[model samples]
Target chain A: MEQRLGLEASIAIAEVVCRCDVDIVAAYPITPQTHVVEHLSELVADGELDAAFVPVESEHSAMSVCCGTAAVGARTFTSTAAQGLALMHEILFIASALRLPIVMAVANRSLSGPISIWNDHSDVMTERDVGWVQIFAENAQEAADLTIWSFRLAEDRRVSLPVMVNFDGFILTHTIEPMLMPDKEMVQAFLPPWEPLLKLDVDEPISMGPVGIPDIYTETKQVQQHLLTQAYGPIVETLNEFAQHFKRTYKPIETYRSDDAEVLLCTMGALSETAMEVVDRRRKQGQKVGLVRIRLWRPFPFEDLYRAVGNVPVLGVMDRAISFGGPVGPVASEIKAAFYHREQRPKIVEFIAGLGGRDVPLSDFGRMFDSLYTTGETGKIPAPTIIGLRE
Target chain B: MATQSAKPKWTELAVGTAITVPGSARQNRTGDWRSSRPIWNHEECIRCGVCVIFCPEGCIHFDQDQPGYPSADLEYCKGCGICAHECPTACITTQEEEE
Candidate 1:
């Protein structure tokens, strides 16, 4: 049965993970992500969920314990944001390399110089090449749903790799919303018991992380990369399977009223929902604008992204984080490269907004569409622009 | 700049390929890199097991028939001379490998 409840997104994500019957959860506390593990610990303490919630001293140890549990064929989980995720950077590569299907909730936060614990893509973007199957959730319900889906997809025989479920820090993690949380039996039907590809056992002990020594280092990485690339099919299949079970459908690149759109706005994470509202308001005013939200970030969903833009004459890609002194922004640069080989492509306008938990007002989104429409009419390309910057 | 002609065939490891040996490092002989070998002076030995405790490689085993005299297994030992340095009796000596 689907239960509708108003709860913080972090708690909702924990409840779903509980229903999934994760074997172990190990984490360290950091802002915007603390509530996730706290709730999981509460559930475990109350005996409502039977699992070992190991509280480690640092995020680095948290991730290491998670990898240890996963290597021993336990369904393991961990959560972190910003600096905490950065601390786990070294182990992040090993988790994927060892093919440990450990699920991590990265409540995305910005890097600090100003020491702000705020929402941005800077954290997960830093781990873009860590080889985990990564997906971004735009809202609380999506966050909850994806947490369950991650384990199913990550542990799939064809894709025995770690998965990162990234949702915007504070924006979604702290916000309370009416969420349809699935029950245990329903989730059980969707995900089966854990079947690990490799495990540490006395009877059948196997070696992991030996000296690669140049002769096989490249081959090892080649195999890891190839497995991830081939995982694209299994990803789609699992999403389809989830939809059939829960009646909640998801797409890699979701389109909003783009059928007749001349200009398109693209984004990821929680901001995409805000972008949708702006697109709706502009559409009501007959602006012919639409929105595209990227959910699957890893294997990049290139084909779906290309199909979603669909020759829209002007495309405005909104990035919540900066690539800093690089071309446009991360998302915009990737979009441009995606369309580089195509003859008929849209004139792309890049917008960097909503860094460090700052709100990007609906009016700012309006101004961005105006700039994109102007670029379409004048055939003059604008420099990669920053909106909502204080003068 | 130098380039190798052959590359790893990426197609071979499609989905479930693992780059690991599993269970044992017996296939690898790590002792070949040792510059010096530890030699035992049986006459000066005090059976305090100080050499056994100080050997970083833990390759030394007590020769029970010789009444608690510890000896080194050279196959896995990368001679660091920690046993000789820590031996209270000055019984163990490090000699340069002849080859």
Candidate 2:
């Protein structure tokens, strides 16, 4: 059951979710995300996978159907991109607040109005506060691995939060890569069938989607917040277990060449691999530059990121999407906010780049370092600059 | 045995909380919290049935030619505020429970 030949990450994800024995998958056809559902549909047609594959009309309906199926104690999954995710924006909050352990694959893409069918962080950046556990993938291997990892994290009794594994749309989805596909039995053992503590049951005859009075509404939200924050410890433990079994190490935040470096470049997703290359090349030139790769975006990973970047003289925060009115990029803004109230902090510089699938050449890392160094010395905010934009 | 002492401790706990529990009150109406007080503006009514059709919870009802909307089941409204937001002419309002 191993295919070394070329296969898209989206299709690989489809195969893994099918083999994982997902009870239901409700997805709408959208660019980048369509291949995932299309492959799953073929699995259903050929009788390879025994699951309810609902081809919903819109992403909103897709997510709504997933919520319904997952709430009934079914292990459910779905995929969407860009405006499709924008349409599911309202129910996204409900899925998380209700604490359904539904997992989603978000083929990250730019938001529309200019309507670009390319890669960007705009789609996920807008839903940052939707209360889902967000994890970014650097490659097809991480993308597939995170999908399995997401299930374990989401279904942990303490968390019970939906997870969105965000991978750049065209960068990872369409790119052909040789991925190490784990054995089906191993994945099955790693992620057992989801048995919810509370779900719709015919024999039990319990009411779900109940009305929340204000007296109890605040307490429910408090419980959700507490679970999301407290679940981080268990999530780290589960990740360690996955690492031991599969020999794949995943951290909420990781540092490359930061041990003895003076300046650090912060990035996420597929771009971090490119930045790591730059860090290596710069290191050879006797420059004290390191790279901080943020794997988890939501639940903010504040403490992990803070400790990872610790006392570095200069820190460069790079983002793939614009925050519009915000002073810095959305990710950059959050990172800065983490250090703002602290007594000790790194000299932070924010840069927005790689919008609309623009090529982020490795040479841009040098410019980012220069900006960071200047900002640290001058005690002035660096102008939000784009590294790889066409004039 | 430990089991014998645990039984008396359970009774003591029940007795301690009994003093705070209302002795005379037979039952409390928790349903009052969900009951909606729908207010209709007679002047702004177009009688379009927009609120009725848009109510996903199906808590609003009105005659086709009525001057104002009527409540089909106020007890089940859950106060989602969809009817209030969906009123085309802004004629209807759903109220919150007063503490």
Q: Which stretches of candidate 1 lie over 4 Å from their true place?
A: B1-23, B31-99
Q: If scored against the real structure, what TM-score would every candidate get?
A: 0.87, 0.80
DockQ score of candidate 1? 0.19
Residue A371 alpha-carbon offset, candidate 1, angstroms: 0.8
RMSD of each: 4.8, 10.1
Candidate 2: share of reference interface contacts reproduced = 0.00
Q: List the residue pairs that clash in candidate 2.
A: none
Q: After superposition, how far is residue B28 of candidate 1 from its true place, in Å?
A: 1.0
Write candidate 1's Cα lDDT for A1-391 as tens digits: 8899998889999999999999899999899998999999999999988999998999999999998899889999999999999999999998998899999999999989789899988898888999999999988999999999999999998899999999999988999999898889988889999898878775775555545556556777877777888899999999999899889999889999888898899989888887889989998898899988899999899889889998888999999778877885898899999999999899989999988988888898899999989999998879888898877
Please give, for every candidate in the order listed, the TM-score of chain B alone compared with the true chain B: 0.73, 0.53
The best candidate in terms of DockQ: 1
Q: Write the per-residue lDDT of candidate 1 for residues B5-83, one digit (tens) a residue.
A: 1244545432233433443455556798898988888899877888888788888889833656888888877889999
Clash pairs, candidate 1, are A207-B22, A207-B23
Q: What TM-score would chain B of candidate 1 score versus the native chain B?
A: 0.73
Per residue, candidate 2 scores C-alpha lDDT tens digits across A1-391 of: 3345467889888888887888899999898887888999999889888999998889999999998998788999999999999999999988887778899999999999789878989999999878788899998888888899898888887778899999889889999888888778889888887768667666654444544444445555665566677778877999999898788899999899998888898999988988998888888989888989999887778889888988887888999888787765888888888999988888778888889888888778778887777877788877778777668
In angstroms, give how far residue A334 of model 2 lies from its true place. 0.9
